[model samples]
Target chain A: MTSQDLFAEISIQAEDFSLADEVALLEKDNLTDGAVVTFTGRVRNNNNGNSVTSLTLEHYPGMTEKSLAKIINQAKEQWQIGRVKVIHRIGELHIGEQIVFVGVTSKHRQDAFAANEFIMDYLKVKAPFWKKEQITEAGKTSENWLDAKTGDTDKAELWS
Target chain B: MIKIVFFAALREQLDCAELSLSADDVKTVNEVKQRLSDRNSQWRQTFSNASLLSAVNHDMVAGDHLVKSGDEVAFFPPVTGG
Candidate 1:
């Protein structure tokens, strides 16, 4: 099947990704797209002023990918999306690294915007991911793993 | 017997995930909660005065629903995961 006809969700062990490549895949075959919007969540080196050294992401194996695909399908059914690309990283990653990326393309700005927001909201609350941040201060390291916040649920409920 | 599980914050608060009790002990979901809360002060504090959620067979369920053996029952704070 054409990539655009199906949603793509993957957990990879490679060194990040090329947004250019991902966006290209959305527009790969034929030509019917008018607007393309993408959201990339990066691993910043600081959180509330703490110098983050590394981050570790964990997720439930088969279930995680299934949940993500379901979310993308829901978004596709809602909006006239041409293609959607969702890539999330698992395992340990350093600061200034890429954590997750979502790319959506549609024939109109409204479809692109709605689908992009829908994918992000579902990923935040439903995709079964946990992040542990390792912070460094004065050459000492401490790891702090925080649970998913309540604000994310509120954000997802807006579309529900 | 049915096994009830708690996850994330609820598990942290209850200090446990899976609990085993006889079919006769808990017929309704509410009865399960009451039995759990009666175990200790910790459970009472975690379940008695809180907005707890439950799942039967991994799907969300109400408090008064009946539970069957081998069913996976889960309790948690209103799901905050995404």
Candidate 2:
């Protein structure tokens, strides 16, 4: 496999992933990078004044991966980064569960940090995934679809 | 016929996952939406949502994007996941 193929990966799975594993895979002993940055997003217990019991993530199967690849490609164009790996989970996730992972390695910390943040900001607005919450209110249970936050859109726009 | 699909909350709201329409009757994604919206009041409301997003052949596109036979069109709400 080529460097890009081995270093970069985008996966959408219902199964959970290990950060240590992804970290090891990203670098793979190439040792050319001086800095590594990674970010992990998890399911929160509360949102919008409701206690969230679980979250269900949904995406258009084929398009989700393609969109993520497009985002990664954009990052590759904008930064001198080494390996990049992105993992996003779908299906039911209870509170405190890991939802997403983004890792980047670059020759310096600046590119690593900037590229990591850029991927996350754009992923929120550009990726196809949507979230629905199973929430509890007044001792009753209900489901609500989470709306895209305006702040996220604004944050992404800042990069452009 | 161009295949049309819905995802996430939009699919739940419409109670539809996928459907098809003759390409001869529509030119752009907007026209396909207009045709679908004409089915009833509920459809019209759903289609009228400004935040509604569309894609042709799995690539995100605008309402004016042209559609052709065998192209798969998808509609959904704005993304929220990271």
Candidate 3:
């Protein structure tokens, strides 16, 4: 196995990210990594039966990056993973636009898959990010902050 | 002084994003909430909500967490990100 340093590859920005470029960066100069798993979350056109016009993500500045680093470190402790990259976009996002991405590389497929899921799950709850949705329907429009669902919390708890 | 911040819905509802309070006046996270709630009816109602969550120095903590000068305390609703 090729020795590697544990690092937190995180980006919190308003700009979009290229998945191909991100994956390539993860795979570049890494001969030990045999499996790479990636997950991308996108804004949907409809949510809870309402037409979602757009989504605005808000996050704590200093804490957001720290939380992501902590999460990546936790994943490293649980699995034999290397080069985990997490990118979450903030500010206004249109329907079908990407919101977040989680990529994990490992020597085996099982470790890669498990670490990818673990990072996403922990990011949902542990990270201090929130989403606000704008809805338009029948010539009327409304905006509200999306509440964190109990199901999401429960899902995160399952990993613990 | 300690910095107190609100995020997301809490920020909108309270019409406040950030504020500073003297550390001598508040010793714990709960004390800060109580002092803020005492400001007005709207503030009282918002802070009184049981679902409100808080963090001190960027890490989630319970109400009894002791705070010090220059520390940042944030309150917000549960996170809704993936």
Would you list the clashing residue pairs of candidate 3? none
Give candidate 2's iRMS in Å, 1 decimal.
Answer: 0.7
Q: What TM-score does candidate 3 reach?
A: 0.97
Query: Per-candidate TM-score, first chain only?
Result: 0.90, 0.95, 0.96
Q: Which ten residues in a row have the lowest lDDT in candidate 3 chain A?
A: A1-10
How much is B36 displaced in model 1, in angstroms?
4.2
What are the iRMS values of all candidates?
A: 3.9, 0.7, 0.7
- Residues A25-129 of candidate 1 have per-residue lDDT tens digits of 777773777888998888887877899888877654454677678888898789988877888887788877787888888889999999998888988877656
lDDT by residue (tens digit), candidate 3, A17-61: 999999998898888889989999999998889899999999999
Candidate 2 runs further than 4 Å off: A1-6
Which of the predicted structures, 1 or 3, would earn the higher TM-score when compared with the native? 3
Assess each model's interface with DockQ, reporting 2 decimals per model.
0.22, 0.87, 0.86
> How do the predictions measure up, each by TM-score?
0.71, 0.97, 0.97
Off by over 4 Å in 3: none
**Whole-structure CA lDDT of model 1:** 0.75
DockQ, structure candidate 1: 0.22
lDDT of 2 by residue, A44-151 (tens): 999988899999999888888888889888988999988989999999999989999999998899999999999999999989999999999889999999988999
